[model samples]
Target: MPGDALVHRINRIQGQLEALKRIVTSGEADCVKTIELAKAASNAIKKFAQAYVETHLDQCIEEKVAVKELHGEMRKVVHSSFSL
Candidate 1:
């Protein structure tokens, strides 16, 4: 349930951000529309980061409880997502 909820939330935010990007570059809207879309994109990015951090914390707890070092194993995903 937690994983599903996390993934669903992230996906929805991603979709919204993508749509907003399209609107920003659609060339059919005014500056107000672009500004609003940019704000939406910023909010979506924040939400996505929060959701991902929560999910990662959950994963770390589950791994520690299970006596497994999944944190080290997930370096690729972590780096790709959190690093520039």
Candidate 2:
């Protein structure tokens, strides 16, 4: 619910997968099409994750800066961040 654009993008990606499934089930899709669909899905997910992580840092880490006792919080976030 963060924004209509984010939700719309997600829905469009979902629709693409559903359409791909129909193509495969109908025996119209081949290996190349499947791979391309997968790549598109991966790119969509990567972009979404990047936006989500940025928003979380802006909201949580910025707020944590006001608390002087949690000096290691940022370090922990960096260490535990996605290796991708």
Candidate 3:
């Protein structure tokens, strides 16, 4: 189970997505603004994923494997996943 902090992040991401949807559906949507909103939502998603990974490493990884190398690899994978 995720903590309160992760819930907060999820709420923020939902809000961003909602805002993006509203702009896209509105009649006077600006292209730049829409792109910005989309980027913000994308960034929020990436941050959510990053935070979840950290939480998983802290709470779940200890039971399954060693943290030394696995932690580094996890971070690398997450970072690369979000990288352009």
The candidate that achieves the highest lDDT relative to the unseen native structure? 3
Expressed as tens digits, the lDDT of each residue in 1-84 for candidate 1 is 767876777787778777776776786767786677778767777776777677687766675664346666567566876776
What's model 1's overall lDDT?
0.71
TM-score of each: 0.51, 0.60, 0.68
| Tens-place lDDT digits, model 3, residues 1-84 | 578889999999999888888887787789998898899888888889888887886666566487677778778887899688
- Candidate number achieving the greatest TM-score relative to the actual structure: 3
* TM-score of candidate 1 on Cα atoms, chains taken together: 0.51
Candidate 1 deviant stretches above 4 angstroms: 61-84
| lDDT of candidate 2 over 27-68, digit per residue (tens) | 867888888987888788767767667656567766776666
Candidate order by lDDT, highest to lowest?
3, 2, 1
The better-scoring model by lDDT among 2 and 3 is 3
Off by over 4 Å in 3: 63-84
Count of clashing pairs, candidate 2 = 0
